[model samples]
Target: MISDEELMALMRYVDGECTDEEATAIRAQLAHDPAYRRAYNEVRQADEALAALPLLEPSTGFNFRVLNQLKAEPHKAVSPISLRKRLLHISGIAIFLLVLPSVLLLLSSGQNPVLILDGSWLPAVGDRQAQVALGPYLQPLLFVNGLLTLLLFDRGVLQPWFRQRHQPPA
Candidate 1:
């Protein structure tokens, strides 16, 4: 049986890939060894068959269509860092808006409005003192603003991005 190295050398000889010295050695082997001759003929036949295969031409405007498709896509998915940055931006805006009123109030009145349960400033429900304070509103405002920001990001950014990524090409 012929060794793997002999077979490889035969293939390289058939493909015209061997150096002058290697080609001389393989030619000597092919003349003397029937196995080398057979392997060389097989490799030569396969190479001819592969070369004879018709080259397929793509449809017209293939490059244009591919480029247009790539340009149309905005993003495959939102990265975690970008999402974090977006959330931070929304929160910063909300926090600024929330704090602005209080800052303005403090500046206008020059009085720190503490969490007071005085019913006099609030709408009277009964004899009980209603809770009238910025401290109470702060938590609820933060919660609502954060929730709205997240919802908006999901709807406007994430949902569309995921849909585009998953949708089959036309």
Candidate 2:
């Protein structure tokens, strides 16, 4: 069987890319070796067949049609701020607002003796004084606020930061 280097040399010679010395060596081999001669003839025949085929030309309106098609298609615009990110920011702000009132009520509860003395500040519930005080609900509210704060930090801050770090550069 003919080697890859011999075949490549034959191709280069057929394409008129070989030096005089290389072409001389290949010509000598082709004359002496039947396999080399056959391979060389096959390569020459294929090149000649390809060269004989007519070259194709595009229509006169090809460029205009392509440009018109490109213009007809709508290009999607990428927004700088995504809807999900906006919603996350707005929700984080709202959660912060909710947490503020609970925090203030909890903190001011100890200092404000007048509010504690008068349960009348809380509206009555159907002929009975509303036994429900801010004291009991404050701890649970703070707990929920802590959870929301953690959620906000994770979704709004850590997730986006991590995604940005791991993304493949454009």
Best model per lDDT: 2
Model 1 RMSD vs true structure: 13.3
Per-residue alpha-carbon lDDT of model 1 for 42-131, expressed as tens digits? 889998999999999877699778877774645557699867876766675677577667655754674545654655555655446644
Residue 37 Cα positional deviation in candidate 2, in Å, after optimal superposition: 0.2
> How does each model score on lDDT?
0.72, 0.77
TM-score of 1: 0.37
lDDT for predicted candidate 2 compared with the true structure = 0.77
Backbone clash pairs for candidate 1 read: none
**Against the hidden reference, what TM-scores do the models get?**
0.37, 0.38
Over 4 Å off in model 2, which ranges? Answer: 67-170
For residues 134-169, could you state the per-residue lDDT of candidate 2 as single tens digits?
Answer: 666666777787788778778777787798799765
